[model samples]
Target chain A: QKEVEQDPGPLSVPEGAIVSLNCTYSNSAFQYFMWYRQYSRKGPELLMYTYSSGNKEDGRFTAQVDKSSKYISLFIRDSQPSDSATYLCAMSAGDSGGGADGLTFGKGTHLIIQP
Target chain B: DAGITQSPRYKITETGRQVTLMCHQTWSHSYMFWYRQDLGHGLRLIYYSAAADITDKGEVPDGYVVSRSKTENFPLTLESATRSQTSVYFCASSGAGQGLISPLHFGNGTRLTVT
Candidate 1:
């Protein structure tokens, strides 16, 4: 199995709805968990990140990681059409070098926020 | 804003041709990376450099070459283009941190098509 796994979802939701995206990994060494948002024809940008396990929040976005279960999630509160984009889960297993061996990414989940 | 730039935002080449994608960053980050995004594959690491003259292979490195002769530039070259090599490529940079968990700054990306 691939190191990381995620559902390729074209999840459609109405504006103001709450959206939850998830990913699971088989590797236990992944220490840094990140969420990236990618717009069409654009590069993925870091939206939120967490270290080891626990929760980190930024405005309407919240990221949670459970290293024990090898699961990570991103939740969007009061979503909007402006939030429509592909969400990718990325993690790294490296030393102090930062992103050593690069990041292992899961197939992104496509999200559409309807107006 | 990252100040990371990629050249030839769009490229088209035939099989057996050689093509180069350029990446440059102004932050002088200690780490640089190359990743390719394909359908159902999210973003896959092609190659990365921790510093000038230090490079390593990621998940998919075959048929590709990278050189980090300078601290701010990381170029990816396709030795012999194949239809399978057609994908959107992104260049990213980051600072040194434990577990390499620092946020990655990515370029707009280069779209290459191999006919």
Candidate 2:
């Protein structure tokens, strides 16, 4: 089984709808969790970040991590067309020596906010 | 100001050929990484460097190689390309290693196709 698993979602929602994207991991050592957004033909951009298990909120986005369950989630409020992109969950473990090892990424969920 | 840039945004090569993708960052980050994005696979790390001359293999680093001769440049090379290696390649850099909450900055991906 893959270390990190995420549904390859092409989920479509109306504007202003609340969207939830989630990921599950098999590794228990993952300590840092992050969410990235990738637009077509562009690189993945960091959207949210969390440490260990807990919730972190920024602007209209919220990231929740449940270490015991090995699950992570990203909540988007008031979705917009600009939010239409691929949402990726990434994690890292161990001491990064001021920078951790490479991040383990999920398959990413493709989301579209319809007008 | 260009933060991070990738050369030859699109590349097409034949199998068994040697190809190198260039990644440059201006942030002077301590960590740099190489990842490939394929269908059903969000992004898999191929290699990463903690600093110049300190490189390590990532999840999928069999047919590929990386060198960090400088702090700002992390190049990924496909020694002998195969049809299965056709994917979108991305390079990312972070200011600090794992434990610290550092967000990664990414370059516009390089789309490589091996036939």
Best by lDDT: 1
lDDT of candidate 2? 0.89
Residue A71 lDDT in model 1? 93
Q: For residues A31-58, write the lDDT of model 2, one tens digit per residue.
A: 8888999999999988887789999999
Please give the lDDT score for candidate 1: 0.90
> For model 1, how does the per-residue alpha-carbon lDDT over A24-108 read when each residue is reduced to its tens digit?
9998988888899999988889898778999999999999999999999999999999999999998887654245457889999
Q: B31-63, model 2: which lDDT tens digit per residue?
A: 898889999877988898889999998889999
TM-score of each candidate structure, all chains considered together: 0.95, 0.94
* Regions of candidate 1 where Cα sits further than 4 Å from its true position: B97-101
The window of 10 residues in a row where model 2 chain B has the poorest summed lDDT is: B95-104
Kindly state the number of residue pairs that clash in model 2.
7
TM-score, candidate number 1: 0.95
Which residue pairs clash in candidate 2? A96-A99, A96-A100, A98-B97, A99-B97, A99-B98, A100-B97, A100-B98
Model 2 stretches with alpha carbons more than 4 Å out: A96-98, B97-100
